[model samples]
Target: MPDELHRIAAIRDPFEQLRQATARITAAQEEVTELARLRRRVIEGLKDQGLSYADIAQQAGLSRGRIHQIRQQGPRPEGAFFGVGSVTIATPLKREAIRARPVVAVEDVAGAQRLGDLARSLRLEPTFETIPVGGQIDLNRPNLVVICGPRISTAVAETLAQDQRFQFERAEDGPWTLVDRESGQVYRSGQDETAPRNWDVAYLGRLPRPDRNGSVVIFTGIHPQGSLGVVQLLCNNLAEVYSATNGEDFSVLVGTEYDPDSQEPLSVEILTPYHLLGDLS
Candidate 1:
């Protein structure tokens, strides 16, 4: 009986120890969370009043260095773990970072005569010069000028300056067409043709050419709406046009909005450009 009581006591002691440990952990977590919440409320309140980090730190009875460290450090307060500002959870279709990419030039107007032959070979009609002023460029012209690339530069200035008509000041939507290597189709947005593209001459670059991977082209235009849908459509259509074409993955970013207050630039982003690649197969 005494041995049985000892065994029971031993089991009860371990359980009691476990309960104590759990209670301690829970208390510590609760304390840390409460402290973090209080600190955040203080910081937020100060921020709401337009207080600088330095100023808020001064008021918090802590050094600016300490407060700043706390604000920027990892392992945020447990309370904030699920609260707002805890994690920077990104949307699945996040846009690419706004920045510039480099590009190589494919043609100068001197080579414009070769465009029709190239377009015909590609089994596609090329849009020559897009006069940015009134109407679309005449694609049938013998001198069809096309730039392929992905970045910004003096080359863009040259393209727009060649025809004042090509310099678009404002725009809305587009049935804009672009060729895709994966999908050989020239996808067009159903938006109005006059809508401005989200382009920055300083940051424009080139997209690689489909036929000769060795060759590339630069272009000047941005779809006011993101190019993802249109690019995907183009990719799918290309698969139909060319039997040998395999479904390849690619991304296209389009659509931008300028802020009214700060005039800051905002754009829609689609991270998985290749999501629809295998759907056709």
Candidate 2:
């Protein structure tokens, strides 16, 4: 309300006042809509926990019929796993060995497109941006999905370092890999070994933003194929993923087995369970 419009009587221009009023009303309506969706989501959770409509109504002081109606209205709660309203998907621009200029990879574009389509299907607006050569993006923004690996983004690397469950590290001469800090298990892309295969592993997680006001979804892999596989996995199993993570700050490792010729994923698996980091600072 910092820029909220004052009384029309105090305004000298009625024309500008009308525009201000309209904008304020629209913003209020949007806030109301999101609040209603959140309430509905809570009711749905109560029901999911084996509570009857009557029980939920009693706890909330609403009628059973109204509770049931609320359950059917608004967007699905799982959709919040991505974002509310609009979402921004950021891919990285990398300097390949042969290319003189850094460029967005074809595989990254494909992955971003799939993620954008997923956002659209959930009734949310989707926008795409390519992280510039340095991979320095605004991490304070809300509803952001970053698909750049740590090797590519210092900002993203700092954010990932806060999550203690999994460590993304690379040796002096080896490929970038993921390590289980607790068990000392290491995950590496199949294409990196001396005898390469058609599979890759990736990291998927909702980590706290730099400001700690909210969270950002981070998905990255050792290679472009690995990130693409994360999208393919989410496109099919977002619900299960949502259920496990439940809108919390968490990280998980995923593996994508792909065809060698086309680099298309043949199968996707959750390499580790959701590692919650809600207590992290």
The TM-scores, one per candidate, come to 0.24, 0.85
Model 2 error, position 15 (Å): 6.4
lDDT of 1 by residue, 1-281 (tens): 56634444466578776776676666566566556655654565566688888897777778887776666552222222112221111101112345433222221232232433333332233344422322222222221223322222333334333221122332224333444434443433333334543321211112222322321122233432222222222223332322122213222323334333432234432211321222211
- Which ten-residue region of model 2 has the weakest summed lDDT? 1-10
lDDT of 2 by residue, 1-281 (tens): 24354464366788987887787776776577677778888887888899999999998899999999888876666678877777899998888778568888888999999989898776577999989988789989889999987888999999999988798888567678899898889998898877888889999989999998889999988887888899998899987888888789999999999887787889999999789897666
Backbone clash tally (model 1): 37
Error in Å for residue 126 of model 1: 53
Off by over 4 Å in 2: 1-22, 52-73
Among all windows of 10 consecutive residues in model 1, the one with the lowest summed lDDT is 85-94
Scored against the true structure, residue 160 in model 2 reaches a CA lDDT of 92
lDDT of 1: 0.34
